[model samples]
Target chain A: MAEYAAQGKLPEVLFFVGCAGSFDDRAKKITKAFVKLLNKANIDFAVLGTEESCNGDPAKRAGNEFLFQMQAMTNIEVLNGYGIKKIVTTCPHCFNTIGNEYPELGGKYEVMHHTQFLKSLLKEGRLKVEGGKFKGKKITFHDPCYLGRANGEYEAPRNLLEKLEVELVEMKRNKSNGMCCGAGGAQMFKDAEPGDKEINVARTEQAQETSAEIIATGCPFCMVMMTDGVKAKNAEENLQVMDIAEMIASADDL
Target chain B: MQYIPNILFIIALAAGIGYFTFNIRKIIRNIKLGQKVDASDHKSQRWSNVFRIALGQSKMVVRPIPGLLHIFVYVGFVIINIEVLEIIIDGIFGTHRVLSTVLPTGLYNFLIASFEILAFLVLVGVILFWTRRNIQKLKRFWAREMKGWPKNDGNIILYFEMVLMILFLTMNAADQSLQSLGVAHYVEAGSFPISQFIVPFFDGLSEGTLMVIERSAWWLHILGILAFLNYLYFSKHLHILLAFPNVYFGRVVPQGKFKNLASVTAEVKMMMDPDADPFAAPDEDATEAPAKFGASDVMDLSTTQLLGAYTCTECGRCTSVCPANMTGKLLSPRKIMMDTRDRLEEVGRNIDKNGEFKPDDKQLLNDYILPEELWACTTCNACVEACPVSIEPMSIIMDMRQYLVMEQSAAPQELNTAMTNIENNGAPWPYNQQDRLNWMDEN
Candidate 1:
């Protein structure tokens, strides 16, 4: 944000590199793949560099409203300072909080989850996917609660997945009635509540029921959860949990 | 001689109305224990919501089988109450069939015929409802949350309706018998299509015996209604009366829209303004700190939320659809609403006993709702959408979570670490902010 303000010119969009995107080992690969796609597509975008902070979605959902407000206010000030409008993020938690929750705190912007942004780019012919490596592979998409139910953007992720030329199977529970991967509402940061089964395990079982070779997700938190579920079930070697961005970047050979 | 009956009638009326009024006052006072909120917006929309959801039974019918049965009971309960108006008037004036005299013969017959049919339908509906709860054990009604008082309370209301309907039918039956015998003041008033079948039970009885049965049934029916009216204050049956107002004041925003606190927003706005002074004295109104953030007790919640607690029907639709609950999590959305109502009642009792709320070491958090249940919630709006009366259990869960984090500084350790990372490095990971752009180099 500081660099963009210094340049006195606006990029086409600001990429909000979420926490997982910035630091988590697995999620960094998704960030790199998406960044590669942007570069290949010639879409001018800039990261906030050190100016970017947590979108505070985790804090807010975890019930630390005060901390959430503090973080959101700081980010809003920087974004407004640079007059940034459109934003895209790899995490649905950030996309949801900034797109739906931020407007109430006076941080209005046109925010899109990365899958939505990728789908839009594909539609605009700025990006193309010929399924270079994933041709005819059977993949199942896991709907992150934030992107699918919270914001009703189920079509965007599915549409992007369809471009990979894979056999896109769906779990029985999908879209509006989709089950949570047990990572939402800050559950990702807490021990599982006492129950007969972990929610992620149940959700992963549903994905596995499709007998797909790949479990594709649109959010970093979901990727973490589905990966954990696959490891728990000892199916890591046979089945891979991946983000849509990683698939798209690999398909484009970027 | 007439004065004695008139005096007895007055006493019954006074006792019923007085007891009902006292309970209503207590409920109002308890609900007022909550903080105030502005549900005064979107008047027209609120009215339509009440009409659609509460009156029209729109949301209830989402599941066809039980939904249709509920409509029978709902419509029966409402339409049967029209007969109560006549009962009230008759008790006061020592008159029989007052409405019959007030309306033409055809209209009176039509009303009586309709009442008889609905009374029979209501009887059947109540029976099916009872069977579903006790015999068939519908999973929703038998969930872990519905275990003790909730279970008993549900059965009690069904039994109450059954007894009332039986009394209504028997009263009509006895009156029908008296009319056939040409007894004076029998008046040949109502059409006893349902109760006609019951007339045989009164066959061959003398005038005095028949009169006794008819009068006693009438008295019991009215008294039962009065008792049920007061019982609502203690029962989940309170939804019978509150569902209307609750739906009227339901949340109008999109399900995903979370409301931001004004005070927090104000502080943030000040910090964001580049031209503003940083060390200036705060505004006079902003001097006082908010009375703890979020809600740890009934007093911290808004009046509308308290109302939602009281209006909860404990139907378990919210729990049945909840992703957390479905996956076997400890969280049950129905239990959240029930716990809130129980805590609110406890607070009300405290105020009633001491003339003000005494400092009870117990609170809504940790006592009624555990952190496990709170943490298990996915914040999916399924609970809110599944509620027939528009109760938002997720809101209360979120608010209590806010209290746990803000007031107590007690969050799960993983969350604490993540929050710490966000505070120090501007993200939820322990990484240097300068290296945030390194993902680009990997490509």
Candidate 2:
């Protein structure tokens, strides 16, 4: 946001590279994939760069409302100062909190999850997926709780995946009744509570039951949990967990 | 000598109403133990919500079979109370068939016949409910959380209804026999469509014997109703009275919308102002703001949340759908509401014992609801969606989490690390702020 302000002009949209996208070794691949796609589509976008901070979704979900507010206020100040309006994020958690929770704190803006933004780009003919390498692979989409149930968005990611021309199998509990990947509400920051089986394990099992070669998700958090579940089940070699952006980026040869 | 019956009737009436009033006072007092909240917004919408959810049983019917069965009990309980009003009048004035005198014979018969049909249906519903709980053993009712008091409380209410319905039919049968005998004051009233089947069982009884049976059944029926009324405070049956107000005052916004704290918003607004001094000294008047960030005990929660606790029916619908609970986690949304009510009751008792709540060292947070359980919650709002009374268990969980994170700084180690990363690097990762753009350089 600060970088754009210094240029005396605004980009078409602010790309909110969330914490995981910015730093996590695995998530950084997704970030690169999405950024390459944006570049190939010739869409004008700018990153917050060093000026960006956590969207505070994890803090808020973990019950640290004060920390969440502090982080949110800082981000809102920078965005408002830059006169930023449209924001597109690769993380559903960021999309959910910024789109839904920020307005109450007086930071209102049009925020779109990356899947929706990508779908819009496709609709506008700015991007195209030719299924270069993923033509006939069996793929299944895992619904992130925030994107699917919390925010009523189950189609954008799936629609993007459909462009890949994959089999696109679905788990039993899909759409509004989609099971959580067990990392929501800040559970990613803590050990699993006492239970007979981990929620991610159960969710991964459901995905595996679909016999899909790849489990596609829209959120970085879902990717992490689902990946861990696949690894725990010793099925990592056969089943790969991926973000919709990564698949689309690969298929489009970005 | 004639005044004896009227005098006895007045005494029974006073005792029943008097005890019921006392219990109502206790409930109000206990609920008042929590903090106040302004749920007075959206008047027209709230009214419609009450009508649709409480009166219409809209949410209840989502499960079809059980939902329809519950509607039978709910509708039966409500319509049958009209008969209770007539009983109250009779108990107070010693009137026999006063409603019969007021209405034409046909209308009176129609009303009696409808009540009889409802009574029979209510009996069938109650019996089916009992079988579902005990015999069929629905997994929800048999969940680990439904042990002890919750289990017994459910069964006891079903039994109470069965007994009440039986007494109602028995009283009607005795009255039918006495009316046939042309007994004075028996007053050939009431179309005993349901109880007429019971008339055969009382065939050999003498007129005097039938009179004793009728009067005893009448007394028992009224007394049983009073007992049931009082028992509501202790059992989950309190939902019968509270579901209306709870649904009416439920959150009007979408499930995902979390309201920002007003004080935090104000502080943020001031900080965003370019002209405002960054290092301005804190205003003395602003010190009056609450010292804590979120709820730790009953007194910290809003009155609507407290009312939600009291209104819980202990039907494990919330827990059954909860992702954490379904995955075998310790979190149960139903238990969260139960713990809140238990803590609120404890606080009320403390106030009663010591004139003010003395610090009990125990709070709704760690003492009753373990942090493990709270942490296990995915905040999916399944519990709120499944609740028939519109209770939002997620609100309480969020409030307590705020307390844990802000007041005590007692968040899990991983969260602390993530929060620290956000503070230093502008994100939840350990990478430096300057490195955030590195992803853009990749590939």
Candidate 3:
């Protein structure tokens, strides 16, 4: 893990596989790429697979502090037992908890959202992403509050998208001020308060106003919420929410 | 001859004493009910924050026009206490203009003029605060959250302020009337400007009528302060006194961390002792009896956490800064404090009246704060960071989370599955634990 970071290679990454990211077989393929990339770079890492669980984010928010801490302590002990020092994850919820919150439970680690790792791979020239011949598609990146404000990571996904030659348009509220997808804090798993307009719906409307073909983001939570927003607005035909890696892997501008 | 003045002075004295005593008692009761004090050292290092922010009216300074207005009122309000003392003195002696005997002509005039100007500023400041809370025009800042004051509370404070201003104006008018009619100097005769304006109207008035107006204004002014002091306890304006101590003793470290679990002694009181049929232990007994993970009630919070709620100015800055709240998550940091306060208030009443302790029900989430809102928090310290008063909303969320996850073992299905996976395989998947290293090899 230490050697990989020093060489600008992927570290001994522990992936936080969340429920949303777990059900899809495509998740395996996406993670398989991550594993292949780390292997090619000779970085030491492990995937906790089903062994990696929820980071008690939902429990904590639900006023279940005991469950939150128990899960937190359990994860911390497991990570330490495995001698894991760094983490890379597809799920922003897990990523935020392990990196930002675990320390509060005496579990400190270098945790990165997967886009951060991929961006590092690109920066190191270790992973060659094939961008086929295509015109630059107008894309607006939705900054996930967890990855962006909570964790202060706003550039990795955008940098990768820019490098891919995608036309990047910004919503009125971007970066730290980015609107929420109404999927955070376990809202993805529960019904929201009764209101005519939902937050994610508002955010999708903002994305629609941007007139972008794709809403690219780094976090899976954003992907799910934005997708829901798109579906609700019936704009799925016009705007697509794609993860940065998926965009890079399939960009027409490549 | 002085009996009437003496009677009014007795009333004012009684009111002020009674009012302050009642508020102090209420504050103590609230504190005892679990308004916390953050043991974190951050508060002490910035001792000047108390004076600068609360006393100096710094937070209000963010909006200069309104800020300046408030500062004027606050300064004037404090300075007017001196005037109250003089009123009390005169009421006792049945004589006015008592201060004129000690102070130079210029000094007395300066004191009165300064107070008058300060009073004017205070009136303007309070009007703005009032309008900001009630009018739709200031909705840009006030909308969507408790921006300034709740409607009822704001109105009460505004009433106090108006009374104070009215008393000041009426007394000045009455004093001027008496002075213009060649009344003997008791306090400085030329000290009041409004009094000068009323002097012409008093030219034909009898001395007795002038004296009656003077005494009436004095009574009103003194009575206003007394009422306000008592009302401050119940009003949102409690921040006036609470903000100082809250800012003075804020958390020292980053607000994310919870206090370390309390240490237990050697005699392990295990309900699951195999010798006593471990598996047969009831759910409640299965866990440690004196379990110290989550806060079951208000008293469970540290002294500072409780204080944080009281000290909160309902600025909505916390809600505004919260990532979860911004993203449309149910979590509103401002509402969390408010709810805690509401619950704390109830808890205080329950303990005082019945001494009953009820286990927090699972519905606490749905009732106190929605489950979605509670789960929406990323444990980010943005709310903590944005708070000018240093209230750590995240800590409260985190502590409650600890209780739900650890004690109840009732978390979301996804989180439960994930946690189980982590426990059995060191990862979140169904694969062999050793294969965890395969990803590293492949990468």
Strongest candidate by TM-score:
2
Query: Tens digits of per-residue lDDT for model 2 on B1-443?
Result: 87787788778778867887886787788777777778778899899999999899988887898898898888888888888888888877888878999999998888888887888888999999999999999988988778999999999999999999999999999999999999999998879899999999999899999999999999999889988888887788899999998998897866666767776667666766789998887877775856567888988888889999999989988888888998888899999999998888888888889988899899898888888888888877778878989999999999988888878888878889978877777777677888888876665
Q: What tier of docking accuracy does candidate 3 attain?
A: incorrect
Q: By summed lDDT, which 10 consecutive residues of candidate 3 chain B come out lowest?
A: B264-273
Query: What global local distance difference test value does model 1 have?
Result: 0.86
| Candidate 2 colliding pairs | A53-B426
lDDT per residue as tens, model 3, A199-227: 77788899999899988876666777788
Better of 1 and 3 by TM-score: 1
TM-score of 1: 0.88
Per-candidate clashes, comma-separated: 1, 1, 63
After aligning candidate 3 to the native by TM-score, how far in Å is the CA of B340 from where it should be? Answer: 4.1
What TM-score does chain A of model 1 get?
A: 0.97
lDDT of 2 by residue, A1-254 (tens): 56557778899999998888888778888888888889999988998888888988888888777678888988887888788899999998889889999887668899999999999999999988777687888999998888877788889988877788888898987876678898888788778888999989999999999999999998888889999999999998899999989998877666
Clashes of 1: 1
DockQ of the two-chain complex in candidate 1? 0.55
Model 3, C-alpha of A153: deviation from truth (Å): 7.0
Output DockQ, candidate 3: 0.16
Candidate 2: regions farther than 4 A off: A1-8, A25-44, A115-141, A154-176, A209-216, A236-254, B104-108, B177-193, B265-290
